[model samples]
Target chain A: MPSFFTGFELAARLNAETRRRVAALARPPRCVALLDAANAGMAAYARRQQAFAGEAGIVLAPEPYPANPEAVMRRLAELAGDEEVDAVVTLYPLPAGVGALEAALALGAGKDVDGLHPENAGALALGAPARPPATAKACRLIAEELAGPLKGKEIVLVGASRIVGRPLASLLLDAEATVTITHAATRDLAAHTREADIVITAAGVPGLIGAGHLRDGATVLDVSINRGPHGLVGDVDVASLEGRSVTVTHVPDGVGPVTTACLLANIAEAAAGRAL
Target chain B: MPSFFTGFELAARLNAETRRRVAALARPPRCVALLDAANAGMAAYARRQQAFAGEAGIVLAPEPYPANPEAVMRRLAELAGDEEVDAVVTLYPLPAGVGALEAALALGAGKDVDGLHPENAGALALGAPARPPATAKACRLIAEELAGPLKGKEIVLVGASRIVGRPLASLLLDAEATVTITHAATRDLAAHTREADIVITAAGVPGLIGAGHLRDGATVLDVSINRGPHGLVGDVDVASLEGRSVTVTHVPDGVGPVTTACLLANIAEAAAGRAL
Candidate 1:
């Protein structure tokens, strides 16, 4: 049977470290989360974030913004300038017409805990000092933990979204890993995955990858969480790889929890930067 | 015999279009070129830039800044705010300790002709409207001219530098191509290149790739210009692939002129944006 890499232990360890960092600060870091509570994805993430923020000793202030992009920008700018707020993050599933870029621009670069700001993204690509998006950071940490140092490893990344795939590829490249990024337009997905030492997927399509994409003993880090007919599902079809020699991380208890912990850690770090 | 994809024709076509664009505008765009003029690489680029700027109908104002990072930043900020300067670019090899990030940060995003500014880099990565680095743009245009429509094509990029390889990989990804980035840490470079439909190299090492790293009918876009025992050499050894049924771009006239043309084109675009 393939070994499963669960996130519970890692998340706990990270949360503990985050808690310690927050406590060391002169005052509790005030993290203002600007999100629309109406969006299903953002709502779910908010719930997890609130819970995690409490455990990490961060002052979580959830500010509900209107659907208007301008209003979102105004709120972000206000929060960015507010002396009381140490860090800020805007969750995904923003209003239909609103872009994360706009929000990232309005939120100050130093306080952008999610690292959605273009400056942060640019820094990551340029190999400068910057905090990467939490989801990408979580995947990198998980990959490093599972496969030791990523240097010289052949990693096949199945997605090309700016938030996850693009930035994560930059991080992996910084670690000196040989990275191949394949997307929906890729001619043959399996042709790329079959040769990978590790396959990281953020395609957001449940059951998109199966045993056909795996090579024996390869480690798979599934970063997608899609709502399927059978509840939540990951990009990988775990059942197909059952009893295989590969090791994999499942949907709910894998990248998700680790991502939350990483965000909290980022908030703590942002707070520390502000403290300095 | 293999075919050669020279940059002269494409460069002339692009330069003519740039000339037309600049002529249509009410005023000639003033471009500020900041460099030491002492570094050999910067000197060569500056000379070409001055000649191209004249051809493109742009006012090229070369400015020299001190070695201190702060001085570079101050000059960039002044030029960014200068109404007369429509575009700004800082050549590579900025004094030994001066990093590009600082210069990029100080240079306003809209006027960054080279697209070195973090905001522009972020915009390119996010699929937003922004100019990419001129060299990356040149490579993409050359690849597209040789191989129609990059969608679903297998491309192997042989460098990981922030200026060329990383941004070029992002540009290729945006074009919907499957990109494999192999750097100095890659175990077997040939293993990745042999299966590629197109191989774009920016690795500075001369003769790093040859016929052994290619498949029949592969299109190779050599983006490196190394000063070797022979006057100037590219990453690919042309003699090694002399009789192969492949397409290659030679040094001196391969990617160099096209890159200069692209930079002039970008200056036009930036000037046009500022005119609005």
Candidate 2:
């Protein structure tokens, strides 16, 4: 069994680092507004905001907007117009209609830290100078920590969502790693997983990856946060891989906190006018 | 030895179908301009245009822009703004860059027949009403033609380019087929292909799939178009699959023409504003 760090721990360390970095730069406090119209829980976001506020001038406003992203974008554009906001972080899942993400990306690229903007997404995809999506950057960070230097490694991602899978794949590919993306409809999912030296599962399916699905000594990064009677379960079955040469990052301590911290880092970058 | 079709034959049939479809609908001549900036081969574009012109009032304009997609997008937007233009089409190769594809997609979803628009791409990924990419659709059509109804069948797609691989996987998933998408980086490409009831290879690697890669009675669709001394070579080594329980599509005739027709169909759909 390997040591596990919860999302809280990751977020804490990230916030600490962000504070130190922001303080060193002698910059003004950053304001981050999370549009929670998609019904993303506010508790986690609040917790992240408080952590940031303790160290720097941080405002975490989770404004609920209409489900229609077009309308939301219009309102967001208006809100952004009024405030001298440093950065806008959106926590909602991909919107229902087309261009929702595109609209978010269009929130004046300089103010967008979420990296879901098409320009940023395209930049990341092309390995150009652009801030990578926070969740994807977090996933890559986890992979880097678990497995040093991913170049030429056979990394298989089990999900291809725009936020996680596709963007992550692009990031990994840019890093010189040979990446394969699998989805729910993928045939012989186990076959692909078993061959991967590193497996990143973000398909949101609990117990999708088990010892049976992976080869011995394979590093597994589970990104799913499925709640069960026991507790939060990941895409990988951590309990079953206790004796295997597998390193499991527990759900709560794995990607969540790191992702939040990365979000803040993105905000800081946007505030600093970092190109990527 | 398995037979292969020349590019000329494929283009001829494709033009005839385009003309017939346009005539049936009593519509104006549809113009499809191939942006060959990536390859800069106007002679090839001219030949393709000639095929279409013989059937309908087609115009072939060769305007080379920087490979960077923003410039290409502006050009596409300019073309889409024309009153005489009904739809727009662009040919893509490995070097054309995703930016070009993205630009083609951004040419107003109403005029995007290739279904490469992010909105349409997302819809295809979600198994919605939007048409799949033309190449992927052609691959599916060929697979079904060779081996009726792919439901419950095992299919393996080599090469996961957004144009062919990713969308093809989505189409197969919609058909209730078990699909696996592998790339050059895949650890055991042959192992997966050998087990598949249908092996569709799109990797430009000439003869990457041969008799050894196919299981007995497996249907093979070679989507690669590699010109060589013996003429065009597909991803699959058609000559080696001679007595095996296999049915392989020729490089020139098989999926190429179907893909062209599918693109024309997508253009028609775009002009008609089917999804709008």
- Please give, for residues B1-276, the per-residue lDDT of candidate 2 as tens digits: 443333345546655766666665545545546556546454475476446554543443445554675566667778778766766666554234546545654576566666655556645543346767788888887787778988768887887676777668667766767666667666677877887888888888987998888888888888888978988787777668776767787767777777766766666555456323
Candidate 1 lDDT over B1-276, as tens digits, reads: 778877988999999999999998889999888888677677667877798889889888877766687777777788888988898877666776677777777787888877678888877877778788999999999999999899999999999888888899999998999999999999999999999999999988888988999999899999988888769888888888878999998787989889989988999999899888
CAPRI-style quality class for the chain A–B interface of candidate 1: medium
TM-score of each: 0.95, 0.76
Taking the tens digit of each residue's C-alpha lDDT, what string does model 1 give over A1-276? Answer: 888888989999999999989889999988887778777777767877788889889888887876687777788788889889988876666777777877778786888877678777777777778888899999999999999999999999999988899899999998999999999999999999999999999998888889999999899999888888889888989889877999899777899889989988888999999889
User: Lowest summed lDDT over 10 consecutive residues: which window, candidate 2 chain A?
Assistant: A119-128
In angstroms, the error of model 2 at A43 is 2.7
Model 1 deviation from native, Cα RMSD in Å: 2.1
TM-score of 2: 0.76
lDDT of each: 0.87, 0.68
- Residue A6 displacement (Å), model 2: 5.7
DockQ of each: 0.74, 0.14
